[model samples]
Each structure stands twice: as C-alpha cells, then as structure tokens.
Target chain A: MTYSTMKPKEVRQLIREKKITTFTSGLCNGYAQANLAILPKELAFDFLLFTQRNPKPCPVLDVTEIGCPEPKLAAPGADIRYDIPKYRIYRYGEMTDEVTDLSTYWRDDLVAFLLGCSFSFEGPMLDAGLEVRHITENHNVPMYITNIPCTPAGVFSGPMVVSMRPMKPKDAIRATQVTSRMPSVHGAPIHIGNPTDIGIKDISKPDFGDPSTIYPGEIPVFWACGVTPQAVAMSVKPEFMITHAPGHMFITDLLNADLSVL
Target chain B: MTYSTMKPKEVRQLIREKKITTFTSGLCNGYAQANLAILPKELAFDFLLFTQRNPKPCPVLDVTEIGCPEPKLAAPGADIRYDIPKYRIYRYGEMTDEVTDLSTYWRDDLVAFLLGCSFSFEGPMLDAGLEVRHITENHNVPMYITNIPCTPAGVFSGPMVVSMRPMKPKDAIRATQVTSRMPSVHGAPIHIGNPTDIGIKDISKPDFGDPSTIYPGEIPVFWACGVTPQAVAMSVKPEFMITHAPGHMFITDLLNADLSVL
Candidate 1:
C-alpha cells in the first residue's frame, strides 16, 4: 500500500505496530506533520513560555496534558509514545538512545509538546509553484545558527536556528506571501538575502543538514527551523529530553489548509 | 494634559503614581492595551495551556517569569505591580479587594500573563469607518456567557465568554476583514446573526457589561472576550488569582499595528 495516500490514522496505526520505522516525510500528503518535544512537568511551564515568547521559531500546535501521552487537540486518540516513526532520547543533552517506541521510558510526570513543522508550510510553497530546492534535490534543507538570539524564558536560551532555501528574487517575494498566511507554522522568511547580515559565516557550509545548490542570481531565504527547541535543549542540557529524529515527525489529522490564518 | 496624546511610558508613569486611576479605554490611543491575569506558580502551567488552547478568547501577549513583576516583552522597564490603573484580587474565587497597586499582594511564586484585549482591534474598526456602538453610546460592550465550552487544559475548564456588537450585515463583513488581520487580539467574530444558536437567550440583557442599542435591521456579532480567563478562574477556584478590573487595562508600548499578522 502507498503510505502517502493513506489516512493519518492508518499510518499512525502501522507505526504503532512497529511496522514503519523510517522518516514520515511525504506520507499522508496534505496533512499537517509535527515535531515532538517531551519534557518533564517541571520543565514544561518554562519551555512553554519560551515557545510563547519566540513564536516564529517555535509555533506550538498542541500540548498534551501533564503525564498524558495523547495529543488530544492535534490528533485525538493518537498516542505520542508510539505514533511517531522514530524517537531520539537524550540525557543531560547527550544522545542516550534511539528507539521506535517510548513505552519503556514513559513516565507519569512527562508532558509532550507538539510543535508546528516547516513541512506543513512546504506543501503550500510547492502549491504556490515555488521550487523548494531541498525536496527537488532530495537532500536535507540547509540550516544555520544565526546571530539572532531568541527571547529567553526561564532557563531556556539560545540563538535562533533557521532553515534556508535558495530561490530567485521574484520567487522569494512570492514565497513570503505564500508562507505568511500560515503563522501556526514558521511564518514568512526571516531573511531574504545577504546571509552575512544575520552572521552566517559561509553560504556553502551549514551547522546542520546538507547544503542545497544556489544557482546564479538565486538568493537564500531563511525561515525559523523546528530544530530550535532541540538546540535550546542541548544548550540547557536538561536531565532528560525526548524529540523526534531529524526529518521524522508525527502526522496529524488536520489538513494543511486548516493551518492557514487567512 | 491630553492623555490620548501621551506616550505609553508617560501614561504608565502617571498610572504608577496613581494620578490616573480611571478606565484606560482611550488612553494611549494607538497603542495596544492588555488584560492582566496573575496566578501562582502551581497553577501557571495549566493556565498557560488554557490560553494556548483557546487563542480566540485568551490571546496571550506576554508572560512574566515566575516571581517577576515586569512584563518585559509588552513594556520593558514598566512594573506590573503599579502600572495598571486597577486590579481585582480574588481569593479562592471570591472577590476580596479592588486596588490600584499589587505590591502588597504580590508573591514570589506568582506569574503574570498579559493578554491581548479587544481594544487593540477597535481602533482599526473605527478607522475603517465602522461604528462601534459601545464607544458611541458611552457604555460597556455587551458580554454574554455562551454554551460554547473552551478546550479544557489541566484543572482549567469553563464556558467561553463573548462580547457582542450589533452591526449591519455589510459592516459585519467589513469588520471581520479588519479584525482578521489582528489575530493576537481575538481575531474575527466567533458567530454572527443568531443569539440562541450559541445559547444566548436574551439579546437585551447581558451576563456582564452593559447592553448597547441594537438598531433594527442590524445583526448581533460576537467576538471572543478577554474575560474568559477570569471566568475560568472563578470556575476552577484556584487558591489565589489577580486580574485587571473591567475597563481598566495595562497599556503596552506596542502599537496596535504591531499586533496584526498581515
């Protein structure tokens, strides 16, 4: 069966049964996908405040009740512990384990946050006829740690991480208009051109993900990345943390159109 | 001095000195005003989640760190304890005191939340040549408790409260377009035309605020109100709570234009 055409529930059930262990990109096309960040109840308030303060980089889609594994708002009846294809476990900011399911690690004191992913906006961009170079090239989008510092909340503080896509000047303007409608996802480009202005050292090298080609006359447009919470988590080095592996995400029943504000 | 012409800082300073303790409705004309909700650290997480779930009714503008009295994002350097004109103190859901200063009641475990008020959108509506009945009639906007239940967060659940404005169908459509740009301030009308459909019984009598004149041929339009957090607080009956009294608000340095997403 083609996974991309399946319903979100069917796909989630397959992953729950340990039948799909790969990235969730391109599956359940037109549905919204989310990034996961599970933290203890103690850290939840501070972390939630952080997302609130810096909404562009960390627009929250849904937050599960304390100790509840179900994301009732984004996808009711979907279990956070097993719906995602992959999970990355961290201890004191260092990678501890990679698991397909979190049943062994689930705790009553844990709170899961489902954050908006750039993938939710990429479909809209493609629909707008703008070329997303990373998808066209079949590689990860180039990401950078910029000089722009995020508004700090409690113990969480770090520089903003942005994902870049190279497009012509006209396409860049059109892309801005397209993505601006969806604020629940990273809304609009943070910087359209001149990477050095935001303290990006080199266009060819990125701190995370693979660099895509920038053809002649095409400039790089940057949007806040979902990797931000993980970066902040690493900097703060909480005693324990859990996040979806890069490129792997939780799919929700909500259609991409449902996320548009306009 | 004309209070409407004064800068936000100047107005806030006057409020801090208790020289201006009246309703802040027309003060700082173009700036955004916020409703205040302060809760102890024990209830902060659940309350913040409630705001996140019900953005239409409780659009959060900024949240202070635990034990902090300054709303750094909305108005840096301004102290929350004395800046607002009035505050209502609630103890176990009972009205205890109405005061101009919160210093005596402030606690180290309290967190203050600044929520976007509908006043932020009223300016744009007037600029668009739409009539605002409450302002013209010199009465409080009519507010009703609707059957619409807000999405519950942990330990916090209550019926949604909405403020109503009567307008012709064409003006209602235009008003929708105007407010839709400002999502941070209770974006767009929740319902239009029918009162009983949303569980409102009498159009002339409101549960809170004063009833305004509704001309014949005009339909009643309802927008989610800032009063929701307070209503929820009363329902849940938290041990301690503090909120701005009706009509008196915290004036922020942010212009109303800054609140608009588009």
Candidate 2:
C-alpha cells in the first residue's frame, strides 16, 4: 500500500505481525515518526533529564512509565515493542543484533522514550518548497559528529550528532523559518555554511548515512540529529539498550502539524 | 542607574516616575519585559484564543483578572496602571494619546494582558554572542505586515506582524536554535530571507520601525513580532484599547534567563 493513502495504525499493525520489516521513512506521510530508546527502569529520571538538557537532539515526544509497552500520548493503541518495523539491540554500547520484532526480548524493568525525529519536519520542509538534499539524491542525509557537547545527566553524555541538508542559500533561509515552527522535531538548523566552523573536517565523509550532493550556490544546513541520543547511549555504555535501527523508525499517531507552536 | 545594577523594583519605581519615558529596551536588563495590551472585558476570550492561535506573535505572558490591576504571574507587586514607562491609548483603532501613567484612564471593565516580548530573548542572544540588529544599529527592529493571516478567534483578527533581523547565515541558524528553546518569547522565526516569500514587497521599506542594513552574505531573519496584538487591537476596534508605545514596554519581575527552556 502507498504511504500517502495509509493511516499510521494500519501501517503499525502490519509491522506488528512481522509482515513488514523495512524503513519507516515516507510511511504514513503526514504522521509523526519517532526514535525509540528503551532503557532499564533505574535510569528513567536521569535519562529524562538528559533529554531535557539536550532538547534539540533528544526532544521528548513522549515517555511511558516503567515497564509499559504503550506510548500513551503518541500512540495510544500501538504496542511499542511490535509497532516498529525494525529494532536494534545494544549490549554494553555495542550493537548486538537487529531484529524485526522484540516480543522475545521484552522485559518488565524497562522504560521507553519516544523522541522527535527529523521525519516530522521534513514533510513540512518539502511542502514549503525547500529541497531536502537526501530526497533529491536518493541517499541518506549526511550526519557529522559536532564538537558541541550535550548537557549530561547521569551517565548519558556525549557530543551532538547533526544531520546536514544542502540547499540553495535562499532555501536554507526558508527551511529555517519552516522548521522553526515545530520545536518537537528538532526545530531549525543548528548550523549553516562553513563546515570547519563547527569542527567538521570533511563534508564528504559523514559518520552515518550516505552523503548527498551539495551543488553550487547551495550551503549545508545542519540540524540537531536524533542520532545524538543513540550516540549518547553508546557513549554511556548502558548495560543494555534497545532502539529502532537507522531509518527504521516507530510510526506515531501524532499529526506532524499538531506539534506546531502556533 | 546602570540596568545591571538596578533591581526589578527599582526599575519599576523609575518607570513610574515618568522621567525614563523613552524606549524600555535594554533597561531593567535581566528582568522580564512585556508587551502590554488592554481591552474591554467583552473582547478578552477571543483575544485569549487569538494569542493561543498566534502564540509567537502574541505570547500570553500573564493575564490579569477583569478589574484587577495585578499580574500575579509576572509582577506581583506592580500595578497595571502607572507602572509601565509609557502607554498609547486608542479610540476606535486610532491612537489618541500617549501617557506614562494610566491612573486617569483606569476602569474596572478592562482586562490587561502582558505578553512576552523579544526583549526577553535579546539578552540571551547578546550573551550568546549574536548581535540584535536593532540594538547594534540604534533603531527599532524593522517590522512588516505579513500576508500570513493569524488564525482568527471570534471577532479579533489581523495579519501577523514580524520583526526582521539580518545576520550572517550561521548567526541566523544559531538564532533559530537559540529562540526555539524559548517558547514563551516568540519561540522562533516565522520566515527567513526573500521577503517576497512571505509577501513583503520591499526589504528597505518596512511597514514599521527603521529599515535595517542587510550586509552581503547575510540573511534577513524574521520573528513573529510582539507588535501583533496592537495590530489586532486596531483591527478589532474595541470601544477602548491601550498598549505600550512602539519602543516603550512594561518591565516585569521575572528574570530573563529563567525563561530559557534548556
């Protein structure tokens, strides 16, 4: 089924049944898609503070109480463990496995955090006539590790990772205006032009995702990437952490515009 | 007295004296500065929804109960009348007089709203090493009447008025990030670059304030200006309306930095 015609719940049900295991980008087009980070219950408050401190990178879309599988605010009926098409299991900061479902790995001592993903704002950016470089080139948006540090809470602390999109200098300006209205989805670009100014040595070699084309008259606009928390999780080396694999996000019931400030 | 050395109460006392009746910008430095709008009780709820719908332009900092002269949340000890440095009284959408004290105009049927002002964010931006064009140029930030229509509530309606700042591309990007963290103070930019994109015809001739200089290699960034409610009040044409003068504003007791989200 085409994403443009599908509702978020219908898409989630297919993933829950193990009938669909693929990237969630472009799925349920107008709905919000979130990044998942499930940790042991003991770290809930500290992790909450971590997201609070670094709101741009780790925007708290919703947080479920300990041992809960449902994301009440973001997706009321959806089961967190089965709603996502893909899952990554990390042990001691190392990726141990990627799976289609996590029913077998479910535990009662876990806390779930649904974080704002760039997918939420990209749709608006496109509607506003702003070119998302990755979409044009059919590649992942390039991401770089920044020298900027995330405000630490407990063991969750690390440098921020930002996703870069190349746009005409004019579109870069428009993109900032469009994205600034949605604070939940890593609203607005963190940096524009001159990669070296933010400590990125090479624009071509991204730490994650495929590099898209940056043409003449276009500048690279960087946004606080959702990858920051995943990087933080790895840096902290939590005994065990579970997340959605890159590009395989958890689809939420929230409409992207509902997150708008005005 | 130097703003940094003056306490909030001292600043209020100075404003009440009618001696410091100029622009309140940069004065009472760390204390909260608000945009004032007073209307007859009949227009209060619609005005509230108008503010809720157009939050960036009309951030509701504090609302006084009908007939009450106190703003409990913003300034407990301050009186709504006679405390602001200056105010404009309007009759049937036309300003008739400007006064430093409202004691003669006080009425029990009126309600006052102290909306958050860009002045609150100016301090943080200055501290973050970003130049506020208006402050640097010693002029009011240029404001334009946008084609963007505010979500109308009841009988209150008007176009959103946005204040412009031209800055380096990187600074525009950083400004977006900085302002995004403060939802109460015109959260973020509504538009950036290409004034025509938002229906503004000319960059040099703004509908309000001094047209600022836009240096080469810089983008013109726009924030939903606090001047919106005044525009709305003019459009609605209530029997009575009062507002802070264009540059003059009300100083509240709240600290500016306390308003930052992260």
Which candidate leads the pack in TM-score? 1
Which docking band does candidate 2 fall into?
A: incorrect
Q: Model 1: what is its DockQ?
A: 0.74
Output the lDDT of residue B171, model 1: 99
Global Cα lDDT for candidate 1: 0.91
Candidate 2 lDDT score at position B173: 86
| Model 2 bad stretches (over 4 Å) | B1-28, B31-262
Cα lDDT tens digits for candidate 1, A32-122: 9998999988899999999999888997999999889999989999999999988999999899999998999999999999988888889
Tens digit per residue, CA lDDT, model 1, B42-65: 999999999999989998999999
> Against the true chain A, what TM-score does chain A of candidate 2 give?
0.96
DockQ: which candidate is best?
A: 1
The i-RMS of every model, in angstroms, reads 0.8, 12.9
Best by lDDT: 1
Candidate 2 residue lDDT tens string, A1-262: 5865699898899888877787787789789889899988666655765665566798777776567798866788989988888889999888999888888888998878898888887888989877787888888778999998886655678899999998888888888888878766787789999998888999999999888888888889999999898778777788889998888888888999888763
Instruction: Please give the DockQ score of every candidate, comma-separated.
Output: 0.74, 0.04
Per-candidate TM-scores read: 0.97, 0.56
